[model samples]
Each structure stands twice: as C-alpha cells, then as structure tokens.
Target: MQRYRMALALLGLAWAAGMAHAASEMPVPSALVGAWTLERVDNVYPDGRRVELYGPHPQGLWIIDAQGRYMMQMVRAQRSGFAAGDKSKGTPEEYRAASLDSNAHFGRISADDHTMHTHIEQASFPNWNGKDGNSAYTLKGDELSYVVAKPSSGASEGAHGEVVWRRLP
Candidate 1:
C-alpha cells in the first residue's frame, strides 16, 4: 500500500500546482481605464442642510490612464440670487483673481494611483487655506472610493468625506 499512498500524494501536489497557475492567470478588470463625467455632487452643509446641485451649472471631466496618470477639471457654478452676467464682468484684474481662485480646487492623483491629493490655496469660506487634504483609493470591481481627511489643531479631529466614482464605458 506504500506505492498507492505515494501515488495519491503526487496527485495532490500536481493539483495544488495547477490551481496556483490558474490563480496567477486571473484577468484584471477592464472597467477602470477610461474617462468619467461627474453626474452629481451632494454637499452637506455644516448646519445639517443637504443640497443637490445639478444641471448645466458646470462641467467636470475625469480621465484615468492605463499608465496610471489621472487628471480632473471642474468649473464653478454661477452664483445664485443673481441673473447671468449680473456678477462682476471679466476685467484684467477680475480675470486674474478668478484664475487664482480656480487654481485652488484642482487636484491630481499620484503616479502610483494610490493617493489623491487636493490643495485649497484659498477658500471662499473662512480659514480653509494653509491646510492639505488627501484621500486613499481602493479599486474593487468598477467602483473606486476615496476617503478624505484633513488635519486638526487640537480643537477637533479632521472632517471625513467619501467620494465615489463609477467607471465609464
């Protein structure tokens, strides 16, 4: 019966090796490498008010490259309670100021596709600048979620926000 036992052990070893090879050949998902448009943004105010902003207010574009380069652009919506073109027109100085403000909300994904860092150079709300915030991204199936956190100054812990992106065809 020693030969029989040896034959069974060899068969088990062969089966394990075949399973490892199959696992290594598993395919990576293809949904992740493409461009996605921002469909909705829900902002929760500090006073427990939730606002849903939609329509052609502004447009956003996000591109994810297979080589791991990511970029995004978002335009701000026009102010409420005022008709279009009611706000200050674009003078050279006004243009310069708006450009500076636009630069603050942009962000980039790291080369490794693991970290997303956003900088707020100047905030319309008080006391938002001079601080850095980042999110870590995890890929599962076709959805990517980022958990954002900021630094605290002993008063309270930093706030957290989750931004989810769905892969586009």
Candidate 2:
C-alpha cells in the first residue's frame, strides 16, 4: 500500500511539472507591431468627473516598428494655429491652448508578458522628456487597451487613466 501511494503522488507531481513547463513555453502573441489609432481616452478623475478629455471624437495615431521605436501624436481636431504664422511668435494664450489639447511622444518601448514601458526621449510636452511610463496592456483581436500607472487620480483604481487603440486596417 505504501508503494502504490508513492507511485500515485509521483505521477501527480510529474503532471503538474509538465503543465507548468508547457505554460511557460507558450509563445507571446504578436499583436504589438504595426499602426494603431487612438479611438478613445477615459480619464476617471478623483474629483468625481468622468470627463472625456477630448470631445466625443478624438484623432490620434501611433506607428511602432519592430525595432522598438514608436511615435504617437494626438490632438483636438481643430487646433488654433499661432496667429503670427511664426511658431516662435505665438502668444502665451495660444501656446497654452495648444499645449493643453495635444499629446505627442516619440521613443522606444520595452515590453514583457503583460507590461510595456516607454522611455520618452522627447515629447510634445517637454515635461515628459526622459520619463518612463509603464503600462499594463491587453490585446483582443483588433483592439489593444493599456492601463498606465500615471497621473494618479487618487481614486479607488489608483491609476484611473486608460487609453484604447485600434489596430489600423
């Protein structure tokens, strides 16, 4: 009876070990390459305002290469141009208006199983330069959504900012 029980226990342990190995051998999905559009952004502010930062419809695109480089730009569709026609001559109000309504960053990204981090070499907003932004991402068919650990809203979620991107057809 002791021998029989030992054999069964060893079999169970072997099976569990094999299962773990198979899980680890599974290939990481190939959905991160290519172009994606910023379909929508939801900012769950701690102040109880679930505001749509941009209007109902926003415009943005991101193109990432297999080489790890990526560039993204998004803005309120109709941004007011610097009235002086020379960018250096823009007024403070015009500059502020443009700054508040747009986001653009270009850099390289490092990703693992469920996480990706961006090292912003340069950004439209200078404050982001040299910053590291980490995000948790999920890909389902043509849509990829990322929940980032940033702009802490001090809410239940801790990080209440989520941005969704659709793989461009």
Candidate 3:
C-alpha cells in the first residue's frame, strides 16, 4: 500500500514535469509583438572580414496582432540621406514607381517566430535592374540577426551581410 502510493506520486510528478517542459518549448507568437529598431548592421565581406555599417539610426516599428496580421514601417533619419542603392529619390513619378517596386521588399515575421524574411529590390545598375533578394533571420530574445544574400546576376555576386536589431522601448 505505501509502495503503491509512492509510485503514484512519482508518476504524477513526472507528468507535471513533462507538461512544464512542453509549455516552455511551445512557441508563443505574442513574444515578438512590438516595435523594433535597427541597432547595428554587421556585414561579412567576401574576404572574410566583417564590417559594421551604421545607418542614420533608422527606426522601424513592427506590429503583430492576434489575427495574424502584421505590418512594419521604417523611416531613416532626416539628417541621414538615403544610400546609393536607395530607390526613393528622383522625380515624383520616379519616386512613386520606385516605392511601388520596392513595396514588397518589407520584412515579416513568420507565424512560428523562428524565422524572419526580408526582401530588397536593387535597380541601381541597368543590367541588374528590377532584381530582388531575400534574407533570413534568427531571433534571440529581443535581438534579431539576419543573413542577406544578393541574387545571382553576375552584377553583384556573392554580396552578403548580417544585420542585428533590438526591440525598442
């Protein structure tokens, strides 16, 4: 009788521990629900040298709702102008066209919160115009690290970089 009760108590404790472990492993989508800003960008050059690129402190906001709807908005600092590859300049018509072309280049967090995908459009060189590339992200707490790869067109081959972001207050 005493032995039987001890066995049952151990079984119950084991079951509770299993439940706790499972709960900890379960991915919570709400954990990533907030605004984030680009803190720093670490670029890996082809020569195996890593370079850090600092932007004009671009601020980005990411919102994830319970309905699985997500939206992000990023704006560069006013004092810091756009990069050479930025397609948001020129005449009004040109800007409109560029914005439309680059609209799909935004980033979105996966439903599992394990992956983040970002798209970027490149139209700088005439030969490489209308080219888009994607980057994959791995998140750790409030930090997100991404690896970006350029498309293969012989124009800008093997161009890759990693960017890290932190959740804003």
Candidate 4:
C-alpha cells in the first residue's frame, strides 16, 4: 500500500513539472514577443496615391507578450492642442480633432506563419470593441509590416492601409 502511495506522489510531481515547462513556452513564436515602435503608417489608394494615415512622423508603441496578448497605440505627431485646456470643456471641433488624431487598442493575439489574428477586447474607438480581425504580416529581422483592409481613419472608401514597425532593443 505504501509503495503505491509513493508512486502516485512521484507521478503528481512529474505532471506538475511538465505543466510548468509548457507554461514557460510562448504561445506565439519567440520572434514576435517584444516592444515594437511604429516606423510608418500609410494608406494606399487604388489610384496609386499614398497618404500618411497618422500624419508624417507618427509616433506609436506596440507590445506583444509571450502569452499571446498585445496593446498598441499610435498618434499624429502634430496633433492640435485643446483650446479649452480641459477635456470636459472641449468644443466640438476640439473633440473631433482629438478623435481623429489617435488610435489605441488592447487585445489578445495569435499568429500563423503569414497572418496575425486579433481579438480586440476594447479600444479607444468604441466601435472596435469585441471585434476580431486578421491581417497578413511579414517579419524580417527587426522589422514587421502588416496591412489593414479597412482602416479606422485617414483612408478613402476603397483604400487599404499598411503599418510598419521596428522591434525595439
């Protein structure tokens, strides 16, 4: 009886160790886990015109964790300040400018060799909350690029947007 009890105990420890090892392995590939900064954000029209979606010299950060989660934010570098100096007191124009100048979202992410899938839990744009999206992506060395079929801002009706990022050291 005692021998059987010892065998069960040993089995439990081995099982626990296996679980811990699996947990330490990332759900996504190691190359995708890191801090990345925006390099460019542009919309390309069918007519071959390229528009800077976040304005020239846009600023942003994206962080992807080993657990298959990510958060991203981007903003126009030359956004106008609120004249009222208080968010609650902002005029309609100020509010509109604010809304059009930035994008932010947080969510879970998974990826295949060529596509990144996202499930946005929440976003600064309320319409995107609870949305699921997929985009084809390419990762080369420290750079990553992806396309959004229908971007939220700064695109003509039929235009698609490209976003590029550089992994941070």
TM-score for each of the candidates:
0.40, 0.73, 0.45, 0.81
Candidate 1 local lDDT, 86-125, one digit each (tens)? 4464556555444432312322233234654444454433
For 6-103, candidate 2 gives per-residue lDDT tens digits of 99999999999999766433432356888998888767665656655555677899988876788988777677789999889999999888776788
Error of 2 at 80 (Å): 1.9
Kindly list the per-residue Cα lDDT of model 4 for residues 130-150, writing each as its tens digit: 998889999999999999998
| lDDT against the true structure, each candidate | 0.48, 0.76, 0.50, 0.88
**Evaluated with TM-score, which candidate comes out highest?**
4
Please identify model 2 stretches exceeding 4 Å from their true place: 1-29, 152-159
**Model 3 stretches with alpha carbons more than 4 Å out:** 1-28, 49-58, 73-108, 117-136, 151-155
Candidate order by TM-score, decreasing, is 4, 2, 3, 1
List, residue by residue over 16-75, the lDDT tens digit for candidate 3.
999976643444266566666666544566777654433336444555544334454443
**Candidate 1 lDDT score at position 122:** 48
How much lDDT does candidate 1 score? 0.48
8, model 1: CA deviation in Å? 58
Q: Which residue window of length 10 is worst by lDDT in model 4?
A: 20-29
Better of 1 and 3 by lDDT: 3
